[model samples]
Each structure stands twice: as C-alpha cells, then as structure tokens.
Target: MPAFVLLIAALALAFLLSRLLRLLAQFRRIQRIPVSTVALLPGSGQAAVTGNASGAQLSSPFAAIPCVFWSIEVQEYRSNGRSGSWRTVLARTSDAPLVLDDGTGRVQIEPAGAALFLQDRFAAQQGMFGGLNQSTLDALERLGVRTRTWLSTSRRLRIRERQIRHGERVFALGEIARAGAQAALASTPDAPLLLSNRDAPALARDLTMRMLGLLALPLLLLLAALLIGVFG
Candidate 1:
C-alpha cells in the first residue's frame, strides 16, 4: 500500500511538472512579444498591441455586469448536511467579440482558446440557504435548469465572475489581420493569442514569479522524494 501511495504521489508530481512546463512555455512566448500600438501592427504574422477594451457593451449573462469579455462560475456549498465542500453547479464564458483601441486604431479580438488574464468584476456569497439573485436566475434559465430547479433553494449558491470591463486597458499578443475595413486579433496554429489586463511590465513581473516557481519545482520534488524514501 505504501509503495502504491508513493507511485501515485510520483505520478501526481509529474503531472504538476508537466503543467508547469507548459505554462512556462506560454509565458516565454508572452515575454518575447513586443508591445505595440494598434496602429503599428501589420496585416499578418506575430503582432502585439496595448489598448483600451471596448465593444458592444453587453451585460455578462452570468454576472449581469457590463464588460468586453467575461467568464463565470456558479457553485453551491454542498455537504453531507453537516460539513461540506463547494460543488460547481455550472460554468460558462462569453464569446462576444471585443475591440481594442489604442488612440490610433481599433482591432477586434477573437478570444476563444486564447490565454486571457482579467480581474474579477463580481463575486458574492449568500448566507446558508440564501436567496438567488437575478444573475443566478438568468444563468439557470440559459443553462436549461428545468430538471434542476431544486438548485434554487437546496444549496448555498455562490457566484464568481471576471470580466475585462469597458475601457479597461489591456494587452494583446496574437495574429493581426485586416478583415476588410476592420483589423482583427486571432490565434494561429503556430502562435497562440494572449490577452491580459495588465501592462507589459506588470505581466513580465508575473511571468518572472511563475518562472521562478517552475524552475525550483524539480529540485523541490527531488528533495521531497529523497525525504520520503529516508523517512518512510
């Protein structure tokens, strides 16, 4: 049993390493991307831009707050009726196109599968068996909650959502192109697009911190293995 546990632990550690390496690769690409104004990017190839996010300012279907892009998670505090854990009731993201304007020009962004880093625009936790808000109700309708209507009063619902608010400064690194009169940002197979709310320096700082952790991870894992072997 101990050996099995050790093997499982080793596999888990390897999975973590794999994920960290992938993130490191992504952040490396982010660091290499040179930030430019929306006007300076070319019609093709790798391009990066910094600008204010704007578009059809629609309310986030889940959060009901206005923004360019949004992601949301609805969870319920579920338990054995005593002690409990949060269970994800549903999760969704907005696919609406966003525009990035940097004084000189505007570029439309297609956000699917792109690395997006934005701040939370709305978060709330109602008390035990609290009332569901309008946002939650709308989300339920959109998610087809007919069979799950019990969700309304059965659990302690909590909502968490993030969005790139209207006029919020953002960074974009992606494939730039001209679609007729409009410029656009998209991800090519070779170069993935990255969208972030932070400026270049702030993003670089975040990358540096994550890279440091990734760099030290292997050594830490090795040390942990050795310690376990000795103490087991």
Candidate 2:
C-alpha cells in the first residue's frame, strides 16, 4: 500500500523475472532438441535419448528400496513463534552409472549433476503425534542425525525420497561421449544433462505449464501496479 512497499515489490518482481527468463531460455533449448534412441545416436552432437533403465540398483538410505537412483532429504521445521521455516538437516544422492536400453541398443550414463524429474516414492512427516517408522528411525540414527530432541514439541522432522527404479522408462538429454568401444550420454559445461522419468512430450508440457505459471504472476503484479498508480 505504501510507496516503499511498491518499490520493494518492484525489485522482487525484477529478480523473479530474471530467474524466470533464464528458465524459459533453458526450456526452449531442451524443446528444440529432438529425442533419439540409443541405436540411432549420431557420432557427435547434443542428444536426447529415451530408454528403459537397467543395472545394479542402489538401496535408498531412508526407504531402503531398490532403485537405479535415489535421493533423500531431511528437513527440520524451526519456528520462533512468529515465523517458521523448514531447514534441511541432511541431503544425499546416489551417483552411479546406469544402463539405458532402447531395444535397439544400450548405453551407460552417469547420473551426477543431472537434473532429475522423477515422482517421489515416499514422503512423510514426523512430529510429537506421529513419527517415521522404526526402521527408518534406526537408519537416521545410524547416520548420526537425531530425529528426536528435547524440544521435539516445538520442532518437527520431515523426510522425502525420490527414486528412479529399474525397468522404468527414462528420458535423457545431453552430449555423447565416447569411451573406447562404448558411447555414453553426458553433460557439458554449456549443455547439462537432464534425466526424467517422463517422456519428451510430457516433460515439455510440464515445462510449458511451469513457464506459464511464472509469466502469470508477473503479469498480475504489473496489472495491479498499474491500477494502484492510476487510482491511489
């Protein structure tokens, strides 16, 4: 309502706009690359490969489920009565090469530094009323992360796990790297790899929806600013 409030809002919107524009640019770049199978992959260039994930699986730390890739995050809710926020206590990810088979061929791809888009396999919260299962609690304790504390009433623990399971369809985008007789899809400085469980079309749709949502907020803010300037 005040001039200072408007100024702060304007600055915030500008910052958000910069981030959104960068994401939009990345979305365009990904959309332009055509999806290719492992067999039809070219000798050299950027590539988008679709195939089924296969290989030795990692045991998820929190859930202990078998997966080609797994990521677990634990956050603790901290509050000062007036405000509250979730603070990450621990985060872990499995970094292993997995085999991708597109029926025509198979390629080994590394998972490090790749942007993963997979559905969460498990998500739950732990509080005074309820807590994570005993096995999970034991695992966390082994990791030296104490889920229970003297101030448990004022704090809550939350955990979530995401995984890429074996035999699941996966989409990978990056440049091709050759090692002797084998070729692998990998990330470059300019073109980082992206791995997702969704197909190309579905992934594109999701990106489009996110971009639209980002654009909508800025437009609404601009319109509101205009109305305030005219009638204030």
Candidate 3:
C-alpha cells in the first residue's frame, strides 16, 4: 500500500481514460457524418466515401506482388539469454495517388499521410536454417537491410506485407475538395485522411474492441490500488 504505487497507478488510469474519451468522441463524429458517393460529394467539407480504387500497379517491397497500395514491416528476433523479443528493423508504406470509383463518379486520393487499415497479404519467417526467397532478398538488399551478422547466419526474422489490390474496394474518410474539374479527397492538418479495406461499421467495431482491451489493464491497476489502499 505504498502511496507512490497508488499514485503511479492513478496517473496511468487518468491518461488511459483521456485517450478513451478522445477515441469515443472521434467515433461519435464519424458516426454522425453519413457516407457519400463520389458523385454526391460536397464541394467542400468532410465526407466518407466507399469505392473501388484504381491506380498504376506497384510491386510490394517484400513480396513483389502487384498492388496499388503496399506496406512492409520487417522485424528481427533477439534473445536476452532466457527470453526473446522481436524488434522492428524496417517499415515502409507507399505514398501513391489513386482514384476511387464508386460507379457514379471518381475522386482522386493522395494517400501520403493517410491512416491505413489493411490486412496482411503476405507473411513469412526465416530462422537460422531457413532462407528467404530471391525476390525478398533483392528487396532487403535494395532497402540496405542485412539479415545476417558479419559472420553468422541471418538472424531470426519475420516479414509481413500488406496491400490493396488494383481495383479493390476501399473505404475513405477525409475532406472533399475540387481538384480542378475533378472531385478529390484531401487531408488537412486537423483531420488526416483515413483509408481502410474495412467499412465504417467494421472499423468502429474494431475500435470498440481496442478501447475495451485498453480499458482492462488500467481498470485492473486502479482496482488493485484501491483494494490495497483500503486493506493493506
């Protein structure tokens, strides 16, 4: 029942509560704004749109798979004698401009700083005896990442690639603006664009689950502190 322990737990709880409140507000705001079609998009203001993305095909960094949008995350496992943990070595995302077609009309999307919620398209792990494919090796080389130490076999590593296939259905949230004669989605400093394969309802459900999971630890800590403070 140390006062410092109680104080630390209380602070952690307060910080997490603030984050939860912010996320809740965001969820409410998104819920209030109805999803719009490209043809019906407002001349100016925030809007959510769903469409099939069209763009020049690009090769994924790790898998070399064709996609319109791609991201790769590379992590290496390190052992601390008795325990092991994975540390990220490289991460990259594509910043390409694409068009979203909803059958009614098309809108341009610049995805540089957008938040992406994409599912993994390719995943692989390599251990001491395992070897990475030539394409992946070439990709790692291009990124200037060496898998092995100076003299030893490559360290245990995992690589995951996420992508949006050309013409894939997508969900987008951002400000709607006119790009010359065409309508487009643009991100502002206050509201960065959000892109996802999942629809709004699905994204909200995922966010709720995340908030619930985040709630558990802080709540448990606060409860423990309270009980200890009362009975210790």
Candidate 4:
C-alpha cells in the first residue's frame, strides 16, 4: 500500500470517528434527560421541554414575515450565458428570544446558538420585468435592495426561509429551571440546546438515523482502502 494513500484514508477515518463519537454522545445526553414541564423542574439543571411558541411575534429580516424563529437564505443566479449555478448572496438567522408555553408555565428561550429543525418553510425565485409577484417584490425591499435596480440587472434571485410560527408545539432541550416568582422559567447560560419542530421521540429517531449514516462512512472507506491494497 502506498504510504500516502494509507495516510489519506487514516485522516478520513479520524474525522469520521470524531463525528460518530459526537453523535453518540449527544444521543446519550438526550436519552438521560427526561422531558419536563415548565411548572415542574429542578431549580437549575439540563432538561428537555415541550411547549408552544408564544410571546412577541418575530419579524423576519428579509420578508418581515411573522414567526417565532426564522432562517433566511438568498441566492443569486450567475451565468456565463452557456452555464450557470445559483450562488448564495445572503443568509441569516433570527436571534430574538421567544416564549415557550407548556400550559404549565412559560419558558423564555434564548435561541442564540440552538439548532432549529422547522418544517414550516418557504422558498421562491424571481426575475426581471415583473416576472415575480408583487409580494416578492415588496419582500426584496426588506432585504435591502432597490426593486428597479435589482430587476434591471437581468439576474434571477432566489429567497429561502423557514419559521417556527406562534402557537406551534415544539421541543426544546436546554438547562432550564424555576426563575423565582418574577419569571416562570429560564435557560441556564451554559446548557446544550436542541430546539426543533419535531416532537421529542421523532427527533431522537432522526438523530440516531443520521448518526448511523455517519458511523458507516469510516468503515466503508477502510474496507475500500483494504480491498484496493490487496487487488493492486
């Protein structure tokens, strides 16, 4: 076996192993923590909670669409007249805190670093000369662009964003506990966060499936490398 070939395979194996380990660790953590209601939890500890999004309605940066949490991605089509691909021009996520109401009480979620998996999403594309709807044109303005100048460029722009709407049930994992009489619940500063539109059980299953796929990569690569060395 060529030393360099073996080295490359080893590096890939290391990366795959790291990812696999991380997935397993995360899964275990999620498993050990039971879901708690906002009204019932220790004063401060890592926990899982299920609730509805409430509090102030979030305004999306690009379209000003109402939501609790949102992610926006804008892409511009680039072409050489013979070949083209959509290129991302702007992407951002909302940092606004949202209230999670579990019927028992409300928990304020600071979603600064939380991973979100929302299914209520939107995506669209528009081009020059009134080729798009009026709403899309108005949305482009909120995203910081002049409608006339944008369409005059003769380039197609794609807008994509997803939101967790108010009154929607969602799962949230973080360090949360009672915050005295003044506040119902609050997330600790150093807690691991996992917020999603899927319920706790379904989200756990999805994570495990993804983890297994990542775990398979290293083994497959190792087997392929061994076969090549033997046959070559």
Best by lDDT: 3
For model 4, residues 1-232, the per-residue Cα lDDT tens digits are 6899789878977887877776675577578888898777667667778899975677775556788789877777778889988888777777777778888977777676666656647777777533557777777777775445444654578777888888889888876643345233333444447778888788878889988898777778778868988996
Tell me the whole-model lDDT of each prediction, alpha carbons only: 0.76, 0.82, 0.83, 0.73
**TM-score of structure candidate 2:** 0.83
TM-scores of the models, in the order given: 0.76, 0.83, 0.80, 0.69
Clashing pairs in 1: none
- Write down the RMSD of candidate 3 (Cα, Å): 3.7
| Residues 1-120 of candidate 2: C-alpha lDDT, one tens digit per residue | 789988988898888788687667667767898988778899988888889998776888887888888878888988889998899999877878878899989887777777666778
Per-residue lDDT tens digits for candidate 3, residues 89-120, read: 99888888778999999998878677667888
Per-candidate clashes come to 0, 0, 0, 0
Question: Best candidate per TM-score, number?
Answer: 2
For residues 191-229, write the lDDT of model 1, one tens digit per residue: 667888998777777877876876688689789879988
Sorted on TM-score, best first, the list reads 2, 3, 1, 4
lDDT measured at residue 144 in model 4 versus the true structure, 0 to 100: 74
**Ranking, lDDT, top scorer first:** 3, 2, 1, 4
Ten contiguous residues with the weakest lDDT in model 4: 182-191
* TM accuracy, model 4: 0.69
Off by over 4 Å in 1: 1-3, 75-89, 126-138, 144-153, 156-158, 211-232
What does each candidate score in C-alpha RMSD? 4.0, 3.1, 3.7, 5.4
